[model samples]
Target: MSSNLTAHHYGITVADLDRAIEFYRDVLGLDVLDRFAVSGPAFADAVGVDGATGGFAHLDAGSARVELVEYEPEGDDADAGAVNRPGATHLGLAVEDVEAFHEGLPSDIETISDPRTTESGATILFVRDPEGNLIELIEA
Candidate 1:
């Protein structure tokens, strides 16, 4: 028997669910689909964390769904790894115009670089979310 897999959603652990939701909705233009809180045994068992509790938000990123979660009694802060680091991952978003998108970004947004064309003919750039999670914007 073979296991079947399909893309459902991408999840990011955030320090603040509310702020993350605002950034995704207002800054990146993703639509807010749903928001809720979870806890107790079922949540703990699913996540493999004891006494787990958190808030979750699902955002619509065009064809993709992005999930943001903030856990209570939060863990220690760790550096959000660079793209070159082992085990580092980033969510790539398709944009209509990379250059224009970069230009309109808030001054406080931390961008890895200005929009640049890839050898494959796509324009792309990296930006960090308010909590330092990396996100890639690509125009093909």
Candidate 2:
């Protein structure tokens, strides 16, 4: 029962769908496969929100698909907090050169750390998207 699981996509809730789409589509080079609107109880239960009504984008980043969700924000506007909190998850993207990719990132992007090599010899760095969702770039 444990062998058949295949990851299809990673869902990230964004504050602005258009902005996220532009970043992932233009900046990261992921193609926009679909754009949809989701709402009602099913969406709410899946997202753990009272009423989730917003746009969704399916992005294909070569070998992976990322689902970008723009949920109607509930609470007051605040910065995304610590990544060590429970339920915090981040996406790791494979790149050819971690150092070059880090240098090529936009100036405004909130980069957490510079590219560094791990014990396993994987070069990686962390950065936050426009909505403050963490993303890790690992050298391929």
Candidate 3:
């Protein structure tokens, strides 16, 4: 077996699982890959394991997939430090219409950026979800 870890999945912590679903499923137009409760010897279930009690929502945005998991906080809880948080990072998605995609993004979209050509010779833009998770949208 290959020892290479080519980013099998990009996982994130969300505040509202439902809202996250709407963003990834409806707005971003990604297909729901799967949703299942994590259990057993999973590291997320262990003591001192910093994660969520809620289930995960896996969404396929093109070839790269994302896993959104929200912690089961009692009330009005959100990750204090957001996209800039230590483990938080952006997930890129290739899109047909960069402009339309940026404009049509939900009101809760924390941020958006004008298209900029990447050093890799591709057009790119930055976007963020309500929870401040960054999404780098590339023109397809």
Q: What is the C-alpha RMSD of each candidate to the true structure, in Å?
A: 1.1, 2.5, 3.8
> Candidate 3: which pairs clash?
none
Give the least accurate 10-residue stretch of model 2, judged by summed lDDT: 73-82
Tell me how far the alpha carbon of residue 31 in candidate 2 is from the true structure, in angstroms, after superposition: 1.7
- Model 2 bad stretches (over 4 Å): 1-3, 45-50, 73-79
**Residue 105 alpha-carbon offset, candidate 1, angstroms:** 0.7
Residue pairs with backbone overlap in model 2? none
Local distance difference test, candidate 1 = 0.92
Task: Estimate every model's Cα lDDT from 0 to 1.
Answer: 0.92, 0.83, 0.73
- Quote each prediction's TM-score: 0.95, 0.83, 0.72
| Per-residue lDDT of candidate 2, residues 91-139 (tens digit) | 8889999898888878887888899999999998988888888888898
**Prediction 3 TM-score vs. true:** 0.72
- Across 65-122, the per-residue lDDT of candidate 3 in tens digits comes to 7988876532454454555677556787888877777778767676655777767877
Model 3 residue 85 CA deviation (Å) reads: 8.1
Which one is best on TM-score?
1
